[model samples]
Target chain A: AQTVTQSQPEMSVQEAETVTLSCTYDTSENNYYLFWYKQPPSRQMILVIRQEAYKQQNATENRFSVNFQKAAKSFSLKISDSQLGDTAMYFCAFESFGNEKLTFGTGTRLTIIP
Target chain B: EPEVTQTPSHQVTQMGQEVILRCVPISNHLYFYWYRQILGQKVEFLVSFYNNEISEKSEIFDDQFSVERPDGSNFTLKIRSTKLEDSAMYFCASSDFDSGGPYNEQFFGPGTRLTVL
Candidate 1:
């Protein structure tokens, strides 16, 4: 079974500042995908970004990027020039190749302070 | 852009009562899934459905729980006898299977908060 871990329970950053949310997972599978999802006050799960394990280059989506270290079993999300809208509960998820189930971390509540 | 949508944004029921959560997935999606999250807990996968049958299920999906796609657009999750522990946010998701590239990106719906008192 794959297990994802997000050590941080909460985080706060000033608006326009950069923030990084850490996540690690234990999986025996060689091929998989990692994802970051955000849940705001509306409580809707929104996909922030995703990274393929096979890709050496990290995934970047505008201000949201990921640092994926396959060997270390680490996938971290970085939010640059963060805005107030970025404040939400962030969760890290893992899905192995050919598997439909997604394992998710507990989540880190992030707040962007003005 | 298409997205998954769930009905009864919030439901409150007594323990031992039956509860059904409904969802409408993307029109073109081929796969459907159900997940739940207890308040302050991580999301947990319950079941995945494809071709009108269950493709995968987790330990959390016990005999008391069932899923059905009764019609063309509606996917439903039914808890036969709800327990207090069953109170949580139920989420419905769907994905399209593309043979080329790992394109099984699941789109999530705004979850329904189920409260069993």
Candidate 2:
């Protein structure tokens, strides 16, 4: 069994500021994948970014990036130049290399103050 | 761009009644999945389907829950008897196996809010 943990329940950052959301997981499998998903007021699950365990290089998507620490089993998301639209519930997810199911963290409610 | 789509943005049903949530994944995608999120909780994976059969399922998916792909396009999740605890937002997701791997990025649908009273 695998479990993801997001210790922060809520966070707020001023518009244009940078913010980092922390995530950690407990898994016995060495090969897996990590993901960050955002859900806004509309209640839609949107994929923000993803990282594969085999790749040590972090994944970056425009304003979104991740700091993946394989040995520590930590994967955190960094939002640069945060906008009001970035305000949403962010979730950390884990998927084993060959498995189909994704185990998700509780989530961190992020608010971008304008 | 192609995306996964779910029908009936919201559904209101009574306890013990049956409810079917439908989704049309990307036409080229070969894998389909169903997940749920209780209010203020994390998203939970319920089941995954491929090649006309379920490839994986979580403990949360009990006999009360079932999934089917009756046609080439539509994938459905049927809850035989809804419980109050079943009230949650259900999401449909799909992904294709590329050279990268089967663990390719999964595209998610808007989700359907199911309210069991």
Q: What is the docking quality class of candidate 1?
A: medium
Error of 1 at B53 (Å): 0.3
Candidate 2, superposed: residue stretches over 4 Å from native = B98-102
Q: Per-residue error at B8 for model 2, in Å?
A: 0.9
Using Cα atoms, each model's DockQ against the true complex is 0.79, 0.78
lDDT of 1 by residue, B1-117 (tens): 888999999999999999999999999888999999999899999999999999999999999999999999999999999999999999999988643558468889999999999
lDDT of each: 0.94, 0.94
Best by TM-score: 1
- Clashing pairs for predicted structure model 2, backbone only: none
Chain A vs. true chain A, TM-score per model, equals 0.99, 0.99
Q: How far in Å is the alpha carbon of A52 misplaced in model 1?
A: 0.8
**In candidate 2, what are the lDDT values of residues B1-117, reduced to their tens digit?**
888899999999999999999999999888899999999888999999999999889899999999999999999999999999999999999988543564767888999999999
- Please report, as a residue range, the 10-residue window in candidate 2 chain B with the lowest summed lDDT: B97-106
Could you give candidate 1's per-residue lDDT for residues A1-114 as a string of tens digits?
999999999999999999999999999988999999998988878888999899999999999999999999999999999999999999999999888888999999999999
DockQ-derived CAPRI band for the predicted complex in model 2: medium
